[model samples]
Target: MTILGFSPGEWFLLVQHELLLFAAFFFLIGAIDELAVDFSWLWLKATGRAGAPPLDSAITQKDRLSGDAAILIPTWEEEQVIEQTVSHMLKVWPQRELRIYVGCYPNDPATMSAAMAAAAGDTRVRIVIHDKQGPTTKADCLNRLYRALCEDESRQGRSAQIVVLHDAEDLVDPAALPLLDEALHCADFVQLPVVPLPQSGSHWIAGHYCEEFAESHGKAMVVRDAVGAALPAAGVGCAIARPILRDLAKTNANAAPFDADALTEDYELGLKVAEMGGQSRFLRLRDGDGRLIATRSYFPATLDAAVRQKTRWLHGIAFQGWEHMGWGTTTGDAWMRLRDRRGPIGALLLAIAYLLLALAGLTFTLEFVGVLPAIELSGGLKLLLWINLAMLLWRAAWRFGFTRSIYGWKQGVMAVLRIPVANIIAIMAARRAITAYLRSFAGVVPTWDKTAHDRHPSSFPSALDAELRFAPLEAKR
Candidate 1:
């Protein structure tokens, strides 16, 4: 079949060549962008400016902490994990100056009850029920908690030095709060590395998070901090100075600082702090025992859940983020903003690459049977492909190394194997994000797309055993 004076074989060759050139051009650009980040990270590491010194676990962090800290946990329907999370946190951190404020809706009795049960008459745990019915944005819930903290300050005649944000499903590291407190002495906003615990039931679907966060938190965040770019909060394991929060609220006419309409309020909060001239730091620390002082959590285990969670992220960070934040004036901020907004574009490229792979396979089969003529690759295209391949190998090696450092050599190997899985998920999530973003034009109000959680790290025997082993070393007072 011929059309427009071209035979079917010629048309196939033309289509393949165009697709290759298109994908190759964008991929090469993306490769260079990634290489820039890699070099920045290497420079920071080589200069001995990457992270803080490891803390001495023998010396209790609670006593060393600079000042009182208020932890704000937001919830909509997190009853299943709230009790375990709160209980474990209280048991692990036994700091007298720490207060946990749990934000719950008036209608979510189950979650409020679970939070109260976890409190068990502990004065540190304050369950603040939102006056609204249910299912408002997480940021809105967080604002209510912030207001409660302010009122508590008025009642107690004292204020918390730091305001830490967390989700109801997070597994708070005992050492994390102290580290944040210490870091707040220098930084207005501090983000701790987030390590996603491997799910026993769903390795590929959930384990991909392990690979992504390992490299992101381990290397990219270090680079961001070194280069003076704003650090985006992982939400669960980040802290902001109470003074900064108060200042932010003042900027918004003395209302609670959080943007109630934002899909990813935590992310915006960090950037907002930086935009307001507040110093932001990403703290990657370890205890003397060699355990990473970071928040660990179980991400979505099922493919549907993972896709949904990621879709919300891409929609918020890539779509709404661009609309809200825009590109700032500084070069570092602009570059970082471009990197943050690359998710959807990267996913598009991945999809095109997959399509080209299938097309290559079909072309090879046809050419072997003499049904189609072989097409010679262009010299420039060949060079571009070679460069991209080199970058891809470098990326894989780093992924393996980072994953191995966090998990083990076995999981590192799995990280390489799971690359395709991660790519596929990104593609699906980006597609859904585009649809969702477009639907917003029709006046579709964006609501929280909460990821469901069932398994908690406390449920694991090893986590329990570790807590028991460290009980003696906790706050001695």
Candidate 2:
């Protein structure tokens, strides 16, 4: 029918169809988000009722020292923070039982020098230069270190029961190593929550990091454990059992334990572990002072760093999800596969939604100016708007309740308001990442997008007051 001659019913039908499709897409995204939130809530409730479990109770003291632990930090041009990272490790961990591996590239003389200086007078810290012949990613460096460790096993004669990955800027909590060792006794892999160091340059970046960590490591991971679903490992603060590492090495020899080709090796490793039928757990480590140990790790303190980091992550997650659709095939469950795909696909949909919203606004304006025909809003349209608004309110309330403190409440409110813009940026980042991945799939390797850290150094106090006012008080020492 011609636009001007179309009957009212026909116009309504077309508008209704468009609205219905949009509503369906919105509802799907909301449902997945809410499900994740609900799972987190249930986990928090259960843990509260059960009381805080003893960190050390998870493993025996004998097991802690029975096998050696390797702390691997992958560094690339991070000379400034490398020393601090190593110093913090030595301060917190007992050097006798734990060996540290600092992976560096031969070209990075400054970082190599700093690493050498950090290792001086400490035999436990070993430096490995990645002088390999090809394209390098963090995963490639990790694989090289793993091979080196395997090769020197005869001389060291250490079992290397647990392998932990930390970034160069991480000021690891003193109790983290012990807690990880304990957690690993029962689970094949363990992940610890990382709180970004507060920086003044951009509150958004810090807030984003905080909210992401809180939900994923704090609440969502607990939920994952309760439901027996596999948990994705955060790149830093993750530990793997020696046997699992060996198996991973054996299975993906050519690629490396952390795939150099993959954008995010940590996440890919987590998926691989799930595929291998190994269980992974996350531990929220608290120190002797009855306070949650918040490590001082640099966030993107500058716009350039923020963009680079986000872009890299966006590309990595999308690439792996799209290219290796059957990585988590052991489960073979249709629902699980869909859930796994949600991260990348959801990101893509979010981006599309923004573009559609803009188009709709422009169309409405044209209709008002007599350039386009007006479309009637039908019952479906009304229902869809109402549903979307309700979901938004529910999510906001859930976040507020979970983060109940005054500062937390303020941050939560601000984050809710910024959701639209933040999501738009995320979508753009994801698209760029996907494009790069497609190119890589066709044999074009992307270089490492190294995020610059804050040069203005800060220190993490060796002692935090035993009482943390914001979070629940920890058990007395």
Candidate 3:
């Protein structure tokens, strides 16, 4: 009847009280943090500062052609989707000075072949083969592409004014290129919203991406930009000024502007630019027909794949990010960085909360059977519980609103239902991330844990068709 000098009933009561108190405390803290961001966004929206910028209807192609823009697409084993991505990009973006640089590992001959076939002797596409073998970090591949860009500039005696980072799986908006170019005239770094396309059979797994990006890019990013916090780049749909990149590279002995060793190079790039007094903007724009000028792509569709991708992100952004990039000097910058690195802590809180839910159900069943006494809740704990409930509703409302604004009402309902799915994935990813981060101290070099994509946005007949309508006749591959 006794274990560790306590009766089973007493142990149950002790655990119930302790777990409830722990979860309630942390949940309240997290709720407060989230509420701050929410209120800031609401204030921005109320003041008309959060609306999308209007498109310049009369801006000619000549106006868009102020300078060349280099598009960098890095690959390892992306043969399946690289061709479609390249073809679609060439078709949609009509800037004559635009050059598409696809970095391929020399060992990945199949992807190289696919990229070349997509190019089909088009001078705009240049495939840069990495000197190293396959499976390097994506940032390393991107550095190779940057080197190629520089060599080309040296040969042609003309430099690209801005460098755009994208993945081989992305279906870029036709308006995105010129818009990025236009924004770069004032801002050092520009990021457009990323619209995650819903997959057919993987709604619960992949659809969470749509919900999260909608809320984060829609609300959180707007507030961050408004409050002078550093804007983290989404990688794809982001452009950086050539001058800033050159300045960044010069700091590192002119080897590479990006932290090739870092897992989330894009995220760091924007922050690095901001650290050096460069301006960063999350530019959301709409066309004449009111379509969001954003990058569209399919995320990981399976639970395992989703967890893997998220694991890399958490490892990079939370663990390694905290290790490499310390706290910011200013209040706003530090607050944003804290939010960025709270993934592991948040996951732990979520795990405990779920466990408490199951335990509460068991406690009720035990009390009904007269096996355990009814536990009295403290007034403070009760107050925390009610506050947490209200906060949960507030969070859910925002999630629903954001998803509805993007994917319509049906998806918004699904977004609320998919909260548990996202939480489970986050917990799993956090565990994996912590394990991987610990292994780094043992000198285990991190490689590109790239996601596999079999489908491209171009595979969908109607996807990006409106954007493709602007393609030149000769761009049809």
Candidate 4:
């Protein structure tokens, strides 16, 4: 005869055990949140009243004068935005010494025609068509361009001092070139903060993008600098010294300048650079009017686009980090390697914490449905909830209260209420990413799942019709 599993008191013990595990997970999340808060506080205190030092003061005039610059734009099917993107680059950029290269595929007639039309009489812009066999990722495109640059240097006996990556959707600030050049005096690689344009018409998506940039670029990068950590390279607004790129090419001959197989090549490169012991700096750029003029691009305007973008990013970052972990050989200086390794783990842990919270909630709900005995809430859970609420308030206040100066209290309250939705989105993205990562590890090559942009092109003011017409082709060139 089968014995019944538990007595009345035994049932209580099982509930207590589950509750303890749940509380333990909550405490772990609270601890991580506390660490983040403490780090942020320390960063703010250390940088108090001390603004970012002037770039001119940080670099010598002689170094600035001697450096040669090149800007690379990699495009696939950006027909609608290419003209406006190129036009803005021509109109706002103050530098006359820049050599601009637009990388495109030969078979894409629409994009090729748009690039040609945009560069009509402009001598500075050179369109390089890659006749590759199949659809490779952006990283492959960058590797091809890098190889071309290397070959050109061999033939012409010239080398670029700095190479900048610009995206088709990015509206770069005019002062970015000089700022990067100045920063290059002190660092080998520099990344500028990027902000999303507010013209997307989806307030929720746009607001989240803005908040992310402000925290990641504005606060997090600054903190990373203070702590002497390697700053992750954002794909666009990145500038790399020729020497570093040359060395990278020589060392990783089998790999592209970026990892073609990886989803987020820019991030991988940044980590690789750090592992190699190089100094990568992030420049916080502001305009002539003293307002921050970060690069503006559109984030996903709809929910579907948002999910797709997040899924792609999550898959890329997770796979790259795991693959590199086993390589064992570290490159960049001590500070760089430590930061690179820590960053991925930190992000992974955060994601795990979010997933655990979701699981705990589900378990709690199931117990209430009588499928399982009701679990008694413990003091540890209540303590963790209070602590988490406080930390969330502090973060919200820092972003909306002090920085944005808009509805601090309201935003802080809303952020707490919206935690369920945010956590759910993150958990779903992470789950999708994990599945993709496993498939990749089992030898499946990832394809470029394209995110459709606002192809209509009528949503925003056209730069082609605005300033590109006034200046002569020669003058603009």
Candidate 5:
């Protein structure tokens, strides 16, 4: 607590070093596991022994069945893209077998109007309005959609085999339907890769999403699938088995499969399904044309918007997840959960590391001018610092490889350069997540912290978006 003959700046770095080393130990454990997964997958792919699910039934089947599944979209103040989102789904999904259930609130007439307009006489689109007022939570809205799906099943005397989840800004892949149909044969929960479109304007804010997701979907998720853990839903590009959805709903007191109070209900659902002995999968499959079938969309473009969205994600992952989902019995599950819930602590470490770097700079300047004694590091501390630095470089290299594979070399290199930016965002997001979590715990009442959306860029010339725009109209006519 007290040190003699040490200047204030020296004291700062000395204390910072201890904190950094403490946090680094935990980070090191995670990095080791992550690297193991990455290396294992590389070996598997090299040997051509990747975990490819069987395709016997799916390949032989000729027609994609519509009644086998339904797509669920929840909207609140999504007037900007609700119609297009619905129309795009209608355009891409199998018309005969798939039914879409869009959830809305009675108070938000604009979104309802947009959703209906997009539906535009298509019998496949069913709009389910929540009984409550607007913007309760995304999970609350999904609960409404689940109830509506049940009612529809009763009305039509038919049951859907799968229920797909998506958001209002998605550009769904037409080829994805058959894959989902095939995946559901053996999986109770299926999650696909999310590919975030580039933002020409917000390179530091929105474009960071591309880098983060590139690493997560490409490497981290592959590890999860390989390890056979419950796959966390990206909240988009995921499908749930209808019977399992009903089972989850029945267990809940309100009969809502999604937890209204959970900030990240989609994520919670994955763990719940896993607890029930269900199979959850995250797969990367290609179409016949060799294109990766993925869900495409844009993340929030502004700094504030990006922070707000990440704040929600960290809150759900670190705070809410701990309170809801208990640490699992297995070693792998505990390790994975520790990785999930380390956000706030990890941000604290990064903040300390940055502060020490700043102090190191100031110390060097002052000592060079003979205003302060030169700061010296012990031999043992120097070795520890060297190890930590090496670890950091390894982490950065892994991220770069994953990002480069997805976004090409330029973005990949930039992603490595953007490590500092990602750290800063994590620090800001963790602070915000803690504030929001404390407020909710203090009985502030958790409501939906809505993230604003932007339509997919028209100038980018997406054949899929163009088809979503015109094909549904033609089909309706």
Candidate 6:
């Protein structure tokens, strides 16, 4: 029967019952999924397998070179922060052991000049100009760098042992190279954790990333390791063995290690390596002073920019991935893929839950004022409702704990408070991602769609002293 024909009492009962069933299905599944991740994290910790291999002495371990490593930094219009990033990175690491290959378009002289100025006569730094025009896909730019490395290798008669990837705004740790080098001895691909510095101007927007990465890098990735799922690279703070890159290039006839057509080439590359029977590791380690070994950078600080960035990720990972990567062979592989593709449905469920909560409040307020009949939930329904509430509390506790582990107690508390804010961003991002994906089929293609960056000024090395330091400042007005 239609709600219009049913009595108010019946209508209220029907709506409440249906909503309860919806909650019982969706949130219960989400809670269970998180429950597994929580348990896996506990197992990793209890067994002492959560930590990285402790070096004999981090600070005292002399400048032992790890052969040769190539660091690839791709830029389109990254003129503002390129100089500082390149300069600081070189100063922080052993210049003789590192070769920084910067990719830029010939049309953009600003970034080219900035990169050249940043290198400042350092023979270790090289700028590779792309043949195409400006703002092509980041993958396209990266491909150019890979080709340059190939030609350089042929000319020099020596190949880099490891290849690393970074975005323009990333601030590398002094220990990141050595650690990545150490980890690569055991695995083909190694991804370190990624930390997004806070922005005061858009706390909700930027802070949400802080909490998200904290939990993902802290807990979810650990679970991924426990289960034999493919390790997805975070685009930065990750390194791959040089030979593996060559194997990946074979798929494209020696053109490039990175896929030029993919939206998230980094994510795809990891999965591709796994498909080729390669082992991957998600390294979550700490430095000598108890600092988490990670790549530090600023995420998009404005709501619109944050949403735009997330939209591209959702389109690439969740939507396009399903079409391109396909279902895997094993149960664990399919399970991980399911989790990867859950973004859109998860956001939709959150929207529905919020709508129902608002409606419930309005209905109860009307009933209390005697404008409508009294409403009530049955015993079974009340029990389910209470269980969901308890699960919310449980999830919030973990979220706070994970955030606290990376950031401090202050940011952890904010993580709990910012759940609603994250949901809003996810909902908006999903909608935009779906639109972008659909538009691609209508003869409109997705290009670089890069997020404009606001690199943390303090994160760069000081002009006064090249000694690298973290100098996060409050967002300006």
TM-score of each: 0.94, 0.84, 0.95, 0.79, 0.91, 0.92
Supply the global lDDT for candidate 2: 0.66
Model 2 regions more than 4 Å off = 1-20, 36-40, 47-64, 133-135, 293-296, 325-337, 356-374, 403-407, 456-467, 471-477
Give the C-alpha miss distance for residue 414 in model 1, angstroms.
0.5
Query: On TM-score, who's better, 2 or 6?
Result: 6
* Sequence-dependent TM-score of model 1: 0.94
Taken over the whole model, the C-alpha lDDT of each candidate is 0.86, 0.66, 0.87, 0.62, 0.78, 0.81
- Model 3's lDDT to the true fold? 0.87
How does candidate 3 fare on TM-score? 0.95
By summed lDDT, which 10 consecutive residues of candidate 6 come out lowest?
A: 463-472
What local lDDT does model 1 show for residue 197? 75
lDDT of each residue in 291-343, candidate 5, tens digit only: 45788887888878878888999999899999999886676677678878888
lDDT of 6 by residue, 34-152 (tens): 78878878998899876654443553254765678999999988888898889888887864878999999989899999999999999889999999997788888888999999999
Candidate 4 local lDDT, 1-477, one digit each (tens):
223877654554465556555645654555575466447646675867224333443332232334668888878888888877787777666355676788888777787788888777887677888878425788878787777777667887878898888877777766677778777877888888786543324545534554556556666576666556656678888888878877777777564476666677777777567667778887664443344535667767666666667777776655565565333242323433343334334445556556556666866776778655665657867666577667666655555532242113333343344444445555566666677777876998886665655442223454222222321111222
Give a tens-digit lDDT track for model 2, residues 79-181: 8888877876886676477889988887788888998888778988999888763237877778888877786686766578889888887877667777777
lDDT tens digits by residue: candidate 1, 227-296: 8888888898899998889999987754889888788888888888988899998888778766777888
* Segments in model 4 whose C-alpha atoms lie over 4 Å from true places: 1-4, 7-20, 23-27, 30-41, 44-46, 49-66, 325-375, 402-421, 455-477
| lDDT-better candidate, 4 vs 5 | 5
Best candidate, lDDT: 3
Superposition error at 173 for model 2 (Å): 1.1
Least accurate stretch of 10 residues (summed lDDT) in model 1?
A: 468-477
Q: What are the clashing pairs of model 6?
A: none
